[model samples]
Target: MSDSNTPDPNTSGAPVPPRPPLPDSGATGHPAPSTPGQAESGTPQPGNGWFAHAPQTAQHPQAAQHPQTAGHHAAGASFSAQPTDTHASRTTDAKVGSGKIVAVLVAAAIVGAVSGLGGAAIGNDMFAANGTSVVSQGSTTVTVNDPDTVNQTTGIAAKTLPSVVTISATSSSGGGTGSGVVLSSDGYVVTNTHVVTLDGASSDVALRVTTSDGKVYDATVVGTDPIYDLAVIKLTDATGLTPITFADSSKLNVGDTTVAVGAPLGLSNTVTTGIVSALNRSIQIASSAVPDSGEQQQDQGQNGESPFQFDFGQGQQGGSSSSGTISIAVIQTDAAINPGNSGGALVDDKGDLIGINVAIATAGGGSSSSSEAGSIGVGFSIPANIVKRVTDEIIADGSATHGLLGAMVGNAADAQDSDIAGALISDVTSGGAAAQAGLKSGDVVTEFDGVPVRDATDLTAQVRALAAGAKASLVYVRDGKTLSADVTLGELTE
Candidate 1:
């Protein structure tokens, strides 16, 4: 089996401090300015700068007050009458002010050397000081330098990237790949359900999760919801997992920094950066909006009569409710998303997940059998706020249900042409709340609790917002007259 460990190391960051320089010996046979202090003898001293005095030696007040040294005292030796070169030269140099100048110059040189060393050390370039050895083990490394490298943001990307996994699923007919964020140490992973189609593989679906080290593991689908299109999966023997951090998606706005990390086009861990293109964009899935007429009808030319009859049951029938548009609200982003990128994370600048990439608008029309269903700029993600609701329901009950009104309604445009206004109910469930409230299939629901409903979509949205078993007053248009009735909503069952 391949090692599941991640071997990538943290990138180089801040610098290190410089090392202290080696002390040099002076020609006069004296320790090179041990510290910044005055000489021990009671003779007048020449050099009087900050660095001129040896800090290690005791200060002589009389010598400091005087401007010159009368004689030279070597280690346990005193110079006599006929002076040696050291004593004669010292006397002449001290008298000419050369002794103090030379001492000050040497002190400055030492300080400069120390400063340069410190700079190189802090610069984080271990090679700058001298080519030192680097010790590394399992994604961690240490480099020896003259000083040390202090990092504030190191280890973050390395720690988080490994936890980010690439997911691929295969079925009998086709396969898909995406990315997922590990949500638990025991192997719970969150990804897009569209990445792994149901395909009757509820228990037999094969999944492969690849870590940063190129190691692959067999994974299993935990549960998924087609409504939200989010799925959770697990792998065996998983531990020490790093879960992704979540950000408040409601607080995000257009122009915010959006960074997508996913396996775009099967390229694992591919990262792309962009901004939120548009918020609350309405997108429609053709399959969801237009149902197939199970029975194919012969071409009837431009009579505009669709073979299938759409029954609007507590939901909006396909018609331009307003502004000639028909689709559910969605979040639009410009971040690069591909067919394989579904279920990957759309994160903020701080690395917090904001959304899950779901679908991209196709180019022209029809589906391509090629492997490259990549983003052409426009991409849509299921809003986290909505996904949260769907996920909660799916986890608790294994399915999501909408509020049911028990009335069969038709599209506003078709009803308008038929001289009907509001929701034209074609049928009502027997013994249902509407039937018990003295309502019939021909009644047109025009309002609810005095709130005017322009079309079925607005009514469904408002009614679905209410919890099941809630009482609502319904107003309908019957034979050019307005009427009202109180009815309790029913639980929607799949």
Candidate 2:
């Protein structure tokens, strides 16, 4: 129960067991300026499980244990950041993990900091003054003319910040703070599950939410989808709150302008800018970082607050080793996401919510964890499409369902079939969707549901992003011949 800034490793993401390293993508990027680093921010909380096929599910036991290399993985290492609080002491917080050439899909609580970030933006003129001020009276009234023009970044901040809020969690175990996006005017909001649950340390944790306009409200967990590491909370008696606009993440492209709004390192309403560094990235990390395996119902949270939704026990999910390694498809950005940025908004140029900020890639390998978690220009976010889908289901039934491919897969690169880049099928579950579609051993999946399949990680992530029983098409190659099939996905099982 120490301050969340420097997390408590044992409570958050305990060290992961040894496994084979993911293949390096040779990813590279300019390091975030050292002016504000993750060193002092806090430990990890959704994580680099010390830590992607981070929803990394495949029928193969070995594939579930070890994910293949992601061509889109960042250069160097991956780590998780936990949310930090405003507490003066950051001692003994969450754990921030790292992996060579992979982002540790560490749960939230292994957060990073954004100290001096606003100053850096000011220096870069990102938050430039509206216009020069005119001085008329020294003591009485000062004359200031309106700005002739507003920069895109400045306008974006003005438009989006009000919809974002700072979330503080409290319990006997010290409290933490993370960011969230207001989804409805009546106070339904979305954030990372790690932020709400203190990276799974205490389900009984209480939450206090503060909006950009200085409004505070007690909130309760409506429901949580730990498989995707996302959660929904409702502000008590809240009304007239600004709801964020959602963008079609499937339509996004690399290099598009991205603005991240969150409370990074407890810095509320903090805004940072960068480009969509990459897209359709399948990052696989240990599932332990994001536990609960399925949907969780809330009976109560934070002082007599009634739970928002009734748990019917209708939605239960697990496919990736019952909390082993999992793979997730994320949008990569250089927008300076720190530990506390979990559950925050990654918006497009138009202030539309395109993704939810999640994890940052710290510099470390499988051997040891980063000293702390922060931004390194390599940050990850859950796509807006998934956010919308999961949030809708949570709001409707207090739970969500994820699609399953029900196949054992490995990297096509491992098969040395250089002719095509895809997920090489080793085995297909009997009576499973894949098997019903005529998929079998020795088949290479070239595409799924119209999305290209680069490897097992990609396939696993795409499958988990959708719901069970969804009909989708697939393309594969067998014996150097391309094949196609229409398949109905199955429900993921523990």
Candidate whose lDDT is highest: 2
What digit string (tens of lDDT, one per residue) describes model 1 on residues 310-368? 10101101122111111223456676665445556665544455666655554433232
TM-score of every model? Answer: 0.49, 0.65
Q: Write the per-residue lDDT of candidate 2 for residues 1-494, one digit (tens) a residue.
A: 01112332345446645434544445544333332222233211212111111110111111111112100111000111122222333221212121011011210111122222233332122212334332111111112233223234444565566667777765554345667788887889887665665544457768788887677899999887767777888999998776767777888756556778776545565677877777877666543335443211110001221111000000111122223445667887788765456677787655667788765554432211334324556778788888888888888888788887767777777665467788887777799889999999888898888787888777888888889889999999989999899999988754
Model 1 lDDT on a 0 to 1 scale = 0.43
Q: Candidate 1: lDDT of 305?
A: 18
Instruction: Report the backbone clash tally of model 2.
Output: 55
Judge candidate 2 at residue 3 and give its lDDT: 10
RMSD of 2: 18.2
